[model samples]
Target: MTEGVDPRELSDEDLFRELQHLHETRTDTLLHGSDDALERHTSRTQELEEEYLRRYPERDVDPDRLRSGARRRG
Candidate 1:
């Protein structure tokens, strides 16, 4: 897990990489870690996600479309 650096301070590419790393850590915790570990990962993932969305609102995903399996026309 990355430490010390603030997500909001990261460059776009770095932030996305951090987000990807968090997702992977969360998945790993869910599969093999203690409940506490999973919870921490979940919380951190949410925090990073919120920051990412705040920084790049255009990249935000629509919850409704996500649930309905709809794709953006681009």
Candidate 2:
């Protein structure tokens, strides 16, 4: 539901929180919502992710790891 809010205006903590919420909502929509709902969620998730990456480039993940279910060991 944070459709039109400017991500740049949010504090880092708030941005992270919003990203987490978006991820959760996207997952829920994927499991139980209609096609239209999923589409909307996907778009919104992408927008948030782009902004997040822009602000925190180091947090970007490798596509291969995502597809292969690999976690970066700390």
Candidate 3:
């Protein structure tokens, strides 16, 4: 959506794939950038996730409980 970055040049499927790739690439870059930047980003993400979990407490479930559910019992 930026200037001179034409998605129109690609086929519909190619454009969609490219967009997905760009999103993942940007996410990877932000997640693994310089130590300070990565720490700040992680802190912000943790804050947001904690806020969301607090707001929707029922959505927060233990990972052990989830694993137990996935385990098969004979």
Candidate 4:
């Protein structure tokens, strides 16, 4: 926690900073042979990002299409 910054209140820049810190911490913990949780989380995150890219080929999608596609069932 940095000063009085609530995570929900943080701007995107602040949130990204926190995310970078978390990534470093997780990487360090993994390298040190910590629990399997970090590995599972990283794998899942990558898988979901890849899947999203695959399902939505457009790099810049229309908002309506994005929302409608997201709402559709698999």
Q: Which candidate is the best by lDDT?
A: 2
**Rank by lDDT, descending?**
2, 1, 4, 3
lDDT tens digits by residue: candidate 4, 21-46? 65666666677744576665466445
Highest-TM-score candidate: 1
lDDT comparison, 1 vs 3, better candidate: 1
Model 3 lowest lDDT segment of ten? 1-10
lDDT of 3 at 12: 51
Off by over 4 Å in 3: 1-27, 30-32, 60-65
Q: Using alpha carbons, what is the TM-score of model 3?
A: 0.48
Model 3 lDDT tens row, 1-74: 12323433545565456545544555776866787755654554444445445555787576657757667431
Tell me the deviation in Å of residue 11 in model 3: 36
Reference-based TM-score, model 2: 0.64
Query: Please, what is the whole-model Cα lDDT of each candidate in the order they appear?
Result: 0.75, 0.77, 0.54, 0.56
- Model 3 whole-model lDDT (C-alpha atoms): 0.54
Per-residue C-alpha lDDT of model 2 across residues 1-74, encoded as one tens digit per residue = 44667777878898788888877686679899999889877886787778888987887576667845555442
Error of 1 at 10 (Å): 1.6
Q: What are the RMSD figures for all models against the true structure?
A: 4.8, 5.0, 10.6, 10.8
* Model 4 TM: 0.35
Where is model 4 poorest over a 10-residue stretch in terms of lDDT?
1-10
What TM-scores do the predictions have? 0.64, 0.64, 0.48, 0.35
